[model samples]
Target: MPAWRRIRSLRVRWLVATLAAMAVALVLAGLFLHSLFQDQVMRQHESALTLQLDQLTARLEFDASGQASIDPATLSDPRWGKPYSGLYWQLDEVGAAPESQGAQRSRSLWDDRLHPEPDSPADGQIHVHQGTGPRGVPLLLVERTVFSAETPARHWRLVVAGDLTEVGDASARFARVLTLSLLALGVLLALAALAQVAVGLAPLRALQRALTDLREGRSQRLQGAFPAEVQPLIDDFNGVLDRNAEVVERARTQAGNLAHALKTPLAVLDQAAAPSVTADPAALAALVHEQVTLARRHIDWHLKRARVAAAQRLPGHRTPLAPVVDGLLRVLARVHDARHLDLGADDMPADWAFAGEEQDLQEMLGNLMDNACLWARTRVHVAAQREGDRLVITVEDDGPGIAPEQRQAVLARGVRLDEATPGSGLGLAIVADLAALYEGSLSLDDAPSGGLRARISLPATR
Candidate 1:
């Protein structure tokens, strides 16, 4: 089939939908958690920078010329004295000439001056921003404007900054771990979804097997207690089977009643036209006899057709081939004993069964074996075997076989061969018709023993 159709199956659709939903949820959660963690980390980093700026403001001093400077000796972190330690402090003279450079900054700044934006914070207020620090590294800067005691007339922009590369590395590491963990969880959940689908739909698989058994004649109805969700379906199917069996039984009774009803009148007509009635009644009696016989034959033919068609669909019909063949051989052997015919049936597997009623089996096999016995010079052999879902039965004899060209013609009802054989020519025709009703076939071919071989094929028990 096509790829789309295969994917559209219930199990596949269930697994896809569940896994898709989980993946989306995991992705969104990962993003939200990562953003929350980054925000908290940045907040903590800013608080530390604020504390360092406060200390820098405390350490602010001026030389004898009113120039603001920081006493590096008073700072707690030794990195403030180390160049490019990723932690630095700087002071810029505000409200000074645009061309004037800032006051001396912490030793860590070296030649790189802290560039405070023109919009500096109000006196004693703080402004936090991210910008380039010494050596072009990213920094989180906290700047505060203060009028130092020694230089009270001028506002100095005091700044303390820390490098952000370490924090960024930490965040990146966290994101990678979070993604891997969530992906692992998703894989586990996908497998759980598959298992859930299989468990949830297990009843459906059981129901399918039960139906198959019913069709194959291994069971009469759906057997086992199903879940409540599926119990009603099984009940309805069993009800349908029961009703179908009832209907077929009714049809069988009606066909039997019809045969008896019609045959009685036909027999009466034949009796009424008997030669004992009058010497001149020969011609009239012959005509009446012929018509009565035709009516009876037609009635029997149609009744059997109707009965077979009705019973073919009813469930729980299995006839063992070996038993039926054995019975037929015993009866026919006695019936044709005076002809000294060698009649026997080959052993077939015990499980070899025709998927139909016993009467139908008897009917088909009887006609074939009887025809073989009638024409056989000495021996009539019968054998049966199973071929896949079909049963194959062969009846062969050593008598003169029908010519290939005329074989097809003999299958027609009332078309007797060899006027002296004393048959209505309906045996093979009836067998063929019954086999066709069972969705089977019958064929005539040359036998291994120089006689005709009649092969019948019918649906077998699964």
Candidate 2:
């Protein structure tokens, strides 16, 4: 392909290249137009020469024996008939008809002279030719046959001439103006292309800044502030962020629980050790084994949570908050058997999905609702809503609520306040950590039914 054609085929470089090309086209068009203009002017100048020849031919007359006559003083032009100003004429006699009247013009007979050849009977035709005229003035000539009406056999030649200095000068002046106009247009086009390049590529810069913000954790996901062309990219980027944050949070929570779980056995070992420098190595060994077991269970629970949330890692894996809430309540109904828990919701978008790993969603909801079910003696109330930028899930129970003084401690990692309950306090902590992972928050408040209200808020999916 040609270089210009190749430039147009590219994505990023086409605009500038096309503008530059149009400028080039303008120049070429100007050149062609100038040629057309000059050609028209030249044709008009030649037509005038032909008309002068015809006028001169009309004055022809025959003598008694049929001999051609002349009238040289009749050749006239208002603007160009001045002496030695390049317009001139000639007349002559030949055996039959002159081959060219141009050769018969007499003003520049042997000097910088030229005359047109008049037509004849056998090869009779008017002829125009270019040559130097009197005083070396560049000129054109028109020639034609001048026949006598009285005697058909007796005809002469007539010629007309013109100078081209004035035409050339005028053409040059017009050409200069035309050339300057084309150049100005080319310059303007170039500037316009530069502005277009900046304007067209602005979205790329915005995308770069948005990606940078995501990397620095200034934003949890790519949001609404983006150009339409780059909107899909921003959305995909947000999906990736959602998945990766879940992965990283799961890993951290597992690591933390592993560390927290080892505390009990180590403490027991410290207390049961024999009084020796080795501190009852067998007892210490047993304690270490128990701690390792506890760490293993904690790791297992975290792994399950991670798995449940992993659905969010896949593209378009968003789970609706309402369905999860409803499912949890159905399970609550079954577990309680004779008891009842009301799961009421209104104005929830039916297809509203949570932007999270599926397992993480399951784990958070499962723990919150299961805990609510266990404590809800008369009824468990569950509801969810989209609050500003969050998917808010509130699980409430009609049972006794935790004391305000102990609420903060209960939320602490592995700080189980209910010793009588057959479970770990990792559930609330895990839920809280998952909320933190999504740049969301969680809180505890009094429920309308005189129970504990667990409010879990996750970032709303785009």
lDDT of each: 0.85, 0.70
Off by over 4 Å in 1: 1-5, 61-68, 148-153, 277-462
The local distance difference test score of model 2 is 0.70
Residue-level lDDT tens digits of model 1 in 1-462: 789897878877888788889989999999999999899889999999999888777777777667778767788898878888888887778877755654567788887877756685778998988998777889998989887566578877778888999889989999999999998988898888888999998998998899899989999999976899899988998998887797678677667756765776677676676777654568667767776777777777777878798789678999888999999999999999899999887878888899999999999999999999999999999987778999999999999999999999989876898889878788998999899889999999999989999999999987
Q: What is the lDDT of residue 411 in candidate 1?
A: 90
User: How badly does each model clash, as a count of residue pairs?
Assistant: 0, 20
Give the number of the best model, judged by lDDT: 1
Query: What lDDT score goes with residue 257 in model 1?
Result: 59
Cα deviation at 192, candidate 2, in Å, is 14
Steric clash pairs (candidate 1): none
Name the lDDT value of residue 453 in candidate 2.
Answer: 96
What lDDT score goes with residue 383 in model 2? 75
Badly placed stretches (over 4 Å) of model 2 are 1-30, 33-37, 40-44, 47-70, 73-159, 163-290, 300-315, 338-349
Q: After superposition, how far is residue 356 of candidate 2 from its true place, in Å?
A: 1.3
